[model samples]
Target: MSFQGEQHPGVQAPTADSEGFRLNHTMLRIKDPEKALAFYTRVFGMRVLRRLDFEEMQFSLYFLARPEPGERIPEETGERTVWTFSQRGVLELTHNWGTEEQQDFAYHDGNAEPQGFGHICFSVPDLEAAQAWFDANNVTFVKRADQGKMKDVVFVKDADGYWIEVVQADRLGQMGD
Candidate 1:
């Protein structure tokens, strides 16, 4: 199962021991946990699955995920932490203690001259509706769905200037030339 013209010259087949392996989460460093948390939870519709604080290190980790319908989240700290780690597609936000207090502190968004990391994506049920919701919530847009060569895809920026690609899963098939 490969794309029509894509090549993977040096790729090897998966080994048996790696069968159960899956991506758990992607971490992003944020300055203000409050604003980041609000943007993620209110705008993206994600819920905080678990939060771990390290007083000695003066930092905290917040794990968030969009809960499925009828899904139950564990209440106990130990159990919730374990559950959060086990789930796939989780977003982890790391907040350093004093960065929030600094007036001119900012993290590299990886989209400038020395670009490295790219963007994270979220698949929505309805692309148009999602766009409307984003507009109503005052979310910043990098590109609108109709702006680029690619149609039916939107890119928005989060509170920390992270690009989030939004698309409808069913429409992805029609995106190819």
Candidate 2:
């Protein structure tokens, strides 16, 4: 059942025309952009690469990514926007106007019953240090690395209760079924 080399049925190979296609970003709706931005930037070390506002629609989008060491981000807005969209693995947070002011407003985290979308993951160099950092930050943990049957993987919740899975790439290959 290993899918490493074998292609699954009904899957088509990439065509030459799609060679440059890349996943630019994943968008998530947030009730409060300020809180969300703080959590992501402080906890995850992601930088706001670009931001766009739709005044008529009463919503704003914030694009974020973890830049490499010594990476140069374009200073000009036009160039930055283009660079932001061209990069792979970006996170986009969409904030609707007035949701933060609503007392009972909440977005479905997709981890409850009838779940659809799942969590996003981050790979860390040192899993133990990351776990300790999350603990120091008072992060709400769905499961600690040592708690569950599936060891060496941690899940923590964000300000909006969306699940975020944390893992170490080297440890992942050491796991057994």
Candidate 3:
């Protein structure tokens, strides 16, 4: 059956429920969009699915995805756009012109070490490969456990010094799923 909004030849269009009730993407402000793009792509193997620049608003946004082994992304970009890939979730990068004030600004103030901000996590196919990449890239870590009761988990920081947690995807799934 042919689908209305399915740009791809054989894919099915999103149904009505898919239109209304959908988890599209998550937007987060970063210090620099270009730097953030490099970090996410180089460290986690994500690709830029789409990018938009709002001249009036003086803002730039990037939608990224972790595609499968050999899948290609569709070419689509529009104002207030979204990017999707063959992955479990989405990551949105928003760059607003001027210092708009940090949403978690208070987390860095009056706190001994900004411990509450937690970390951004990416499940790696291999823990060793992930660790090596982090090491080679000189990404600092809040904590590193050789091996504990929990699966191999390492806490690292991103370009803006935001904490990021790295763990094996399969190991985590085995514990929960």
The 0-to-1 C-alpha lDDT of every candidate, in the order given, reads 0.92, 0.93, 0.67
Each prediction's TM-score versus the true structure? 0.93, 0.94, 0.67
Lowest lDDT sum, 10 consecutive residues, model 2, at 1-10
Which regions of candidate 3 fall more than 4 Å away from where they truly are?
1-20, 76-88, 99-117, 147-151, 173-177
Q: List the residue pairs that clash in candidate 3.
A: none
The digit string of per-residue lDDT tens for model 1 on 85-104 reads: 88999999999998989999
lDDT of 2: 0.93
Model 2 error, position 174 (Å): 3.6
Ranking by lDDT: 2, 1, 3
lDDT of 1: 0.92
lDDT of 3 by residue, 81-175 (tens): 43353334577777776543555432131113544545556777788887888889877766664755555788776666666678786666566
lDDT: which is higher, 2 or 3?
2
Candidate 2 differs from the real structure by a C-alpha RMSD in angstroms, to one decimal, of 2.6
- Between candidates 2 and 3, which one is better according to TM-score? 2
